[model samples]
Target: MANTKKDILTILGISIKPGESKEVNFDVANLHTSTPVNVPVIIERSKKPGPTVLFTAGIHGDEVNGVEIVRQIIAKGINKPKCGTTICIPVINVFGFINLKREFPDGRDLNRVFPGSSNGSLASRVAHKLIHEIIPHVDYIMDFHTGGSGRFNAPQIRIVEGERELNDLAKVFGAPFVLYSKHLNKSFRNTCAKLGKVMLLFEGGKSFHIDDLITNSGVNGVKRVLNHLDMLSSKFKVSVPKKDCILIKKSKWKRAKYSGMFKASATISSKVLKGDILGNITDPYGKFNYFVKADNSGYIINVNEAPIVYQGDALFHISTKLED
Candidate 1:
């Protein structure tokens, strides 16, 4: 991760000196009812100067699991670093959050618009503000997310392949898995990369659901990263990850063969061999039962948790390759 040093930090025109804290509003626009929405940006600085880290979540409104993780980081005072600055934006897409929807009110996916125009759509303006105002002052970013809908993902840190700095930081984050993925076009990660910012995108759990295990993984991983940077407070103790972090080079999704009620017997992050029974699809009248088998021997990273499925719906995401 990159590090920037300065005696004073100014964000959104607010000048914050060392050992100061402030809550600034990332004001985008008001609701349809003319209510002013407050997207609070919590900033904490230590007496000593160090790197500036930005922690953000809820870019996709329904990804409450990610929001919970950031909330815990702030609630537990983990954002109060012993050195440097910590900025927390627990809910970036507050518009979507209020409506319990995934996209902006204008039906735009916030993550798809990056380095946005100031006079574009609502989502674009928000994106433009974030990239132009907040990102410039930050050296490192940790954005949190979860599976879109029914698919439950194991805790993992995702980064583009072949970057030693990202790989080293991902290892320090200490998540259960580190998946090498390419950056999506116009994504926040891609924009940050273009701006020479180091970011670790965290994915886990499912949208609109909060899992304690997943929450702990994210919070702990943040602590580990802060500790590695020598910014963690002395009051908190960092725990070693329970398992070795697996590096996945390639993966494949197992789709359903028959359209029926589905149930997964295989759990996330478990290893399975070819031809192993992973789950089953059954008819409503109990007239038929079809067992879903693994096509290859690999680790299961994501399992669809929805009760119903179509024939082509994805059932399980399994790793097909690993990094040595």
Candidate 2:
């Protein structure tokens, strides 16, 4: 038998031995206000060898709950591990985070740019770097997110339905719901899936703020997965019993027919029957209003919290029919 210790290092060439942590800065962009923006990475390696799991957050900068969740997990410390590595990238979109916006500085969605080109736009370059430098090294990945700004969502896990291994991992993540979403064009999850790595997307709360309940649920979810993988020593006692989750195969956004002050009778996580009143669109004054209702029987997975809206703005995202 041999006792082998693991050596942790960054893409920048800094060394991090077992029981040690370090921040690795990735160059994003250099501007008048600041030099190359850094993507902070927290690495925790165990003396024993195991699979590496990357926990990422802030892919859509305004989504802050996942950032808090990752921060808390790192703060708790990995006292010991049965095997492997856990790398935490709490903020992937540095520019979006600082501007409090959802997309990159160039107004591109980071999530939509994957396996990107090095000679392309800033967002593309970042995506390329991540794919080349990070994705290949990890066995498992958990990309954390929340609803975009002005929308609220129930805590849930998003995965492809037939990916049994991923679905099982989603259960270990313990979100209230697990959405069965197909691969989208150029999305990160799709890219990772193509590479044979099981990636789970945990979504909850809303952008730019922390919801303690959602945050706690996310942190526990990570631990539960780690325990399942035998990376952590302690067994994770699920604090909250798993809630019934609707498996959403397809979702449609209800866009605003006319722009005006909006009022909603339904909230996030509300279940609505066909023709049920969801809300009303009205002029700033008390007169001239139109009702918004569900066209199908389903669960309200996402709702716009912002009162102001424009024509064609997405108002509600519904998951048609529920899954037992």
Candidate 3:
């Protein structure tokens, strides 16, 4: 990716010069009560010009882990880069966030509508405004997310296969696992890719919950990336990852075979062999118990955490192939 350095950064119709700080409102609409909502876009620039990176989270309102990750980045002053610019948007779906839900007020997933039209649904309009007003100002993006309800994900980075630059950056971020995944149509990642913007999507923990381990993983990954770009402040130190990142090329979900109360014995990021006892599903009456086994030999990337599950619900996500 080329450096999108500018002497003057203009975002949301606000002009911020080098070495300036500004909090611009990214709010596109008001609440039902006619009250104004504040979806802040925090931008910090260094005196020296370099690359501009955006840190975004809360695309899904219930993904509090992602929101906490970005919150820590801003709280610790990490967003104040030593060079270039850093823009942080801790919550994108303000409607969902306010209601503690995942979709907009009209029940549309914001992630599904990208590059939206000016006269569209509330979610689509938000997407349209973000793509037009915010995306063009940054060269790189790190969007944080979490697994949907009841599934706990090990800290990982997701990117499309065969993109050398993205692969290298993912390595620099140094998460535990790097999953080679495809871009969904009309998603933020796809829209950014189409517009020639490089993005690294970070997924960790589970929705509606915040774990310190997950938060640290995300915050540390941001530091590593900033350090790699030579934008890290001298006050912060980047730590080397304890283990090498596992590059997963293919994976499959192991679903429950029976409806019952479930408990996972295998932990996230643990290596499991074929037919290993991953967890157990037990009937409410305790009359029967079914043990769930691994389908293949690989690392466990995601584990379902819901206490009660139905047959065919995904129990675990296991890696089937890895890159050498």
Q: What is the lDDT of residue 227 in candidate 1?
A: 97
Considering only N, C-alpha and C atoms within 3 Å, which residue pairs clash in candidate 2? 50-84
Ranked by lDDT, the better of candidates 1 and 2 is 1
**For model 1, what is the error of residue 307's alpha carbon versus the real structure, in angstroms, after optimal superposition?**
0.1
lDDT of 2: 0.80
Quantify all predictions' global Cα lDDT against the true fold.
0.94, 0.80, 0.94
RMSD of each: 1.2, 3.1, 1.0
Candidate 2: worst-modelled 10 consecutive residues by lDDT: 1-10
Positional deviation of residue 223's Cα in model 1 after best superposition, in angstroms: 0.5
Please rank every candidate by TM-score, starting with the best.
3, 1, 2
| Model 3: residue 39 alpha-carbon error in angstroms | 0.3
Point out the worst 10-residue segment of candidate 3 by lDDT: 1-10
Per-residue alpha-carbon lDDT of model 3 for 1-324, expressed as tens digits? 333455788899999999999999998889999999999999999998889999999999999899999999999999999999999999999889888899998999999999888899999999999999999888899999999978999999999999999999999999999999999999999999999998999999999899998999999999999999999999999999999899999999999999999999999999999989999999999799999999799999999999999999999999999999
Candidate 1 residue pairs that clash: none
